[model samples]
Target: MTFTLVVPDLRFSRQAGFNPLTEMALPGLASLLGRADRNQLGGQSAEQWLRGHFKAESAGAAALSRLVDLPAAAAGHWLRADPVHLRADRDRALLFDAGLFDISAAEAEQLLSALNSLYAADGFEFVMATPQRWYVRLPQAPDFHTTPLSVVTGQDIHPHLPGGPTALQWHRFLNEVQMLLYGHAVNDAREQAGKPPVNSVWLWGEGPEPTGLAKPCRSVRADDAQVQGLALAAGLPFRALPPAFDASGADGELVLLDTLGRSARQGDLYAWRAELERLEAAWFQPLLAAWRAGSLPRVQMILPGDEATLAASLGPAERWKIWRRPARLEECLVMGS
Candidate 1:
């Protein structure tokens, strides 16, 4: 095993209205709030507890565990005052990652079984895949704080990635996607009323291409050259991109990619649930009221396997799913409403 990946279940995340961009910002809050420093990203007081047994064998495993920590307040005072948790399962009982391994399947499964058994006492579940891939889903919920938005200044309160640049641009990009999705539905509604199509914000791709490679690190202590050869043999697009470093490039187009590869072993379901609640309070409620008054145009929508069910949880809207791929933003139609 040479390269490792700790990923969040994006389906689980999408079901909860979370994008990886938003997911990437929370850990830095621990540092900003003075609750943690670089070394303290793993545990509240003891870093060894996280490093030794938190399964720091994978590439991004160590970085994943230290994502969240206990808030400054003991009794949810900060959360109560801020009330800005994510709209997904905040409780992170399961930390899932893909491990690169060269051992036999039987050997891999045996190792996975042993790890599961070892962590089972602590309510952790470990899953392993072929070719040296592994995932550890922690079952216990750890105490942590969600990133807060400053009410007074309307400022974001999460720590920025390395260069102190918060990925709010990514957040706005996702918001635009959501808005476009909603607007597309609204455009369909207006068509029935013999209305014009909606306008949409055209988005383009910019910034660094999102590659899973964190650094040129070892791949499970295997021959790096050999691993690259194997990857090429297997036709894996595994080359590390030259350091683009810039999330906000001149291109300015928002690049959306699969981001299941950077989740932590820590659980935080409260943030998940809160995000849904906020959407309900902010976006869905207004849409529903408009629908009830018949002032809202009949919106066209697409539904996926469970988007309808999930949307029901969010709020009332006419939605349908055409196809899921490179989910593109068509246009937004502002009707009479």
Candidate 2:
């Protein structure tokens, strides 16, 4: 599994406030809400108590009022009960979970549909990489996206979140996936720290197949520095590329973003499977080489699929950097697999 991510700084953080509602979707709420200090209900009932608090908001409460739409209406009460610091603008938003899962193509399509409808009003640009992966351009920077130990999971999301399969379950599931993709050493770090997997949020981001890795591949085309910085922090080496463009007879500059793999949406597993194979083979060699050399250096590949899988290979401590630039794009064929 692999994906892409957009890394923003603090300026981006101020643009978007913390979205705690998504946090509630995770498994353990007691530690997050500081319920161990509260004398009311023991920490065990924190989830239920938190939900109740958000449900009791007065009609037309301040900025919080906007969050209540029948589904989230219940949360209003919780906000009223346990008032915490909140700001109008958010901090940062990242595009992730791209091509990092094993979801079927049809399932990916349904998930994307739900995300498009749910966040349509936000005016974020949606870039489709494959049927399952995508990138969202947000009006505000979301603070939650940059967490070191975050989990993003999406199944068919037409009905409601945290329904039968809770967000925490998805978080745990993704962590397991991360372990499978990155290696058990990644999970070991979290366990040693005595902290539950860190960044756990259940919701839809683009289609289910590509998940969140698609867009970062393009964004990395331009901003390799930030991506490289993240990779270095994760104790990985960053690989540099030559150029991505050609002067030969070409059909204009098919801006990589516009040429996203194929027309296949999340619903088309057939196309996704073929593309995935092509991508893995292209990227695995370099990554495997890096691993063998004991330098986990981030390598740039021409295929978005390669970038997605490479991203998935990173654990909470690992970061994959994608950059765009003629200098950054190179001919994978020249490597001579």
Candidate 3:
């Protein structure tokens, strides 16, 4: 069985006097790094890579995620309208991910109700799949493209709004929604409670579902909604990533281990190092043992960051090449950066 491990931000920003490998020993990962073949998979965020893997047409996060509920026959008929998460900064609005917000389901419901009331006449409706994940359905799909939210976190959103033929209409709609939400009672209550208000919605992922998508792996194990959604859409078996790896039973499975992305994005090198050590003990160590014991046939590590991805292919023979000394994790990060 082939195991594909997707590790986001495996590389960390360099510090004046910091060495990750010195703090934690990751022999397994080091061995793989030492002998495995490396290849560059272009420059794209992890989300963009997944979209390409699933053959998704719409670049919107909503478009790819909405496929989980859409039937195959009606795939191309409807466009996915995902909610944009915005933070009300001092003077300008900041675009960020939903994970950074503290929105509750009840609060989302209240805010969405007001939005739906105003947008219903425009043939737009909002649905909150989760407090963090919101959606909107368009009567007729708009002809526009949007930047992924991952790329714009912590930056002003005015320059990154949707663009295309219907850009004017979409911008107007966003202004109207922001105005309505700004004055809603929910925002007032949130302010009183010392919470960030849901003041605006970013509409994006406006395109039809992809066609002729093929499953890349036999089975998928992941914690991400997009991975699970892609598995569902492709008619493949999927399970949540188990806390431990059972090398004896892992065959023909894809495992997505997302432990480092958050810290890397936040530029918290200390936290990034801590998480890397934990992953080293839990994953890399055991997997290396399995590969050395001939229990595992092949393992592929896909490390994705904001700009590029590094793919490493490892096998039993590669691990035994003691001449290829293990390099520090910092070295890998520096090369990638």
Candidate 4:
């Protein structure tokens, strides 16, 4: 069988003052690295890499919404609004993703209702696919560019806001939405309950629906909406990632493992280490055993980051190379860094 494992944020920031691998022991990961053939897969954000895998130029709000069976407009552009925290300085506002703000479906509905009523006259409507994932359809595509949310979390957003002919209009609408949300009763209740109020929305992934996505693998196993959406759009079978590799299944399966990304983004090294160890035990160890037993023909582990992707392809023959000693997780991290 052929299995492709995609792990996002597997590499830690070199500037974090401490090495991430030093905090954990990853025997299975180290063993895989020791025997596999390594290559660089170029540099790009996780979203960009995943988009290319599906042969999509842009797999943003509209493309993802399409996969979830949402209605689309002929000339509409995706106006994805994510709840965020805006810290205002003397001259600018620094935006931070409100990662801890857990909104319920009821709360999301209430906020979207207010937003829809306020922007309906402007030919904008809000659609909530989930409490945290919301989309808006615009009458015309905006002549502007937006930075992906992954690139701007916990950073200043003023420089990354939309830019071009329709930038001013989009900016103005964002400000209006902020003011409206700031005064809404829902936010008032949240603040009273000591929860971070749904203060503002970050508009991004602006584009029309995607077309002609490709199916690179026979089956897909992942929890990411983008992967699942691409699979659905391509009419491919998809399943949630299993707890362990099942070599008894058919060949050619694409598995996406994303536990590393969240903690890395949050700068939680402790959590990152714990998750890595868990992955080693749950996935890497089993796969390694299968390869040794000749039950699995090939396994490819792909580590994708904002800068670059590190890929290791191993087969039974490669695993038998005892001359190559298992490298520490730190050594592999340096190659990626």
Candidate 5:
């Protein structure tokens, strides 16, 4: 059987001082890295790569995620209208995604209620899937495209906001929402308690019902709503990522490991090290043992980073490649590019 592991922000380096990422004692990863046939895919996002794998290049994240997240959102053109925080930095406004902050169910309810009431007559409805994920269902899908919330996180959002012909119109919508959410009771309470305000919504991932999606793997193991949505759209079985790597049997399975992303992006050195260690202990070590014992045949690793994506293929035959040089973990590693 064939197994594939997809991880984001794995190929990365520290900004300064000791680079714990390269120093991890991942014997399995090191062995595979040395033996696997490696290649780089420049300028491609891990999300986009998943879309390509599932042959859903035409699909939008909103439509894909909605299939799993907002199932009641039937018969509608949808867009991911996620809550965010815009902070005034030195020269530009940085977009802080919902993951960077916290919002309780009560806060989400209060915030969405005010928003829904204000826009009830505007030909759309605001639906909250989770505290962080919100959606806008429309009668017809818009023609413009939008940046994903992940891509916009911790970056200047001036150029990433709604673009295309509807730029002015959506810009106005953003301004109006900011005005409405400014100093609301929720924000007031949040500021009083020392938390970031739920001040704005980042509009992105617009989509019409994603069709013609093909299942590329036997099953999908992922924590991402968008990935699960894609699997569901393609009629593939889906499961959440377990604590460790156990294929538990699939002819070919697609597993997404993205937990390392948050700490890596935040540049939390010790946290990053700890998460990597967790992966090494839980996944890589066991995987190597199984593969060496011939329980698994072929393995594929997809490592996505800011500058490029790396693909490494491994097989039993690779064990015989004694002449292969030791792999450099930092070869494709680049952080915060």
Candidate 6:
């Protein structure tokens, strides 16, 4: 049996401040990195890595995610029209994800209703399985692809917008949507309550629906929508991440840890550190102990980040390869000073 860990947002820049990981005890993480054969994962984010795993070349993540809650919501091309706030800087508007405002189901419904009611004639419908996860059933998919929201969160959003023949048209449509959201009672209440308003819907995750999928792992344990969706689409057993590894044994389990990624996307360093600590105690340490005891046959860890995603693997035989000594957590990560 083998265990694969897909942990994103562990990469951090060597910036000046209270480094959350500097003093943290991470013997398991360190040992695992030290003994494993290391390589660079090809994709930029966890979603890309998982996509390649399932050979889902044209599968839009939006559709896959929607299927988790509404398994029957398949059969059409779907887009992730996630709600976001575009914060205006001096020269550019920085994008922020939905978690910032803690939008309620009622608020999400109010906003989604207004957009659907206004754009129904244009063949656009807004639907939500969860308040934070929204989808758009378009009459047809757009011509171009879009960057994931996590890619540009807390950064300038204009440059990341879909570019091509439809760019200008989308811009206009978004502006109209913004106008509607601006006058909505939800935003009015949010503003009065001193919170960011739901300003725009980030339309992305466009492509073909998931097809030709095969089980990459025996079982799937992840907290990510795309991962869970892929597992379901492929007919693999799926479950949310447990607090710790199943002590009985692992059977080709693939775990995706994204709490760190979410905090990173939201620019919450404190939360990132806290999550790192939690995973260390719950996941990393336990996996390392199990692997060392030969309870597991193999261990593989993939850290998906910006340019170079870190990949490492180890087995009992690796313990004899003293030359490949364990590395410091900072050394294993691609950091900026």
Q: Which candidate number would show the highest TM-score if scored against the true structure? A: 5
lDDT of 3 by residue, 49-131 (tens): 66676676454455556755343323332333334456667877787566665778888898888888887896776777778
Question: Model 4 over residues 19-66: C-alpha lDDT tens digits?
Answer: 767657677888887789988777776667667878876656456744
**If ranked by lDDT, best first, what sequence of candidates would result?**
5, 6, 4, 3, 2, 1
lDDT of 2 by residue, 107-185 (tens): 3344444445654675533333334333344444222212111121122222222223244654553344333323334
Model 4 TM-score on a 0 to 1 scale: 0.91
User: C-alpha displacement of 244 in model 6, angstroms?
Assistant: 2.5
Checking candidate 3 for backbone clashes, the offending pairs are 1-252, 84-202
Which residue ranges in model 6 land beyond 4 Å of their true spot?
14-20, 322-325, 335-337
TM-score of each: 0.17, 0.20, 0.86, 0.91, 0.94, 0.93
Clashes of 4: 0
Return the candidate ranking by TM-score, descending: 5, 6, 4, 3, 2, 1
Give the worst 10-residue stretch by lDDT in candidate 4.
66-75
Model 1, residue 235: displacement in angstroms? 36
lDDT of residue 1 for candidate 2: 17
lDDT for model 6, please: 0.81
How accurate locally, in lDDT, is each candidate? Answer: 0.26, 0.26, 0.70, 0.76, 0.82, 0.81
Give the deviation of candidate 4 from the true structure as CA RMSD. Answer: 2.4
Pairs of residues clashing in candidate 4: none
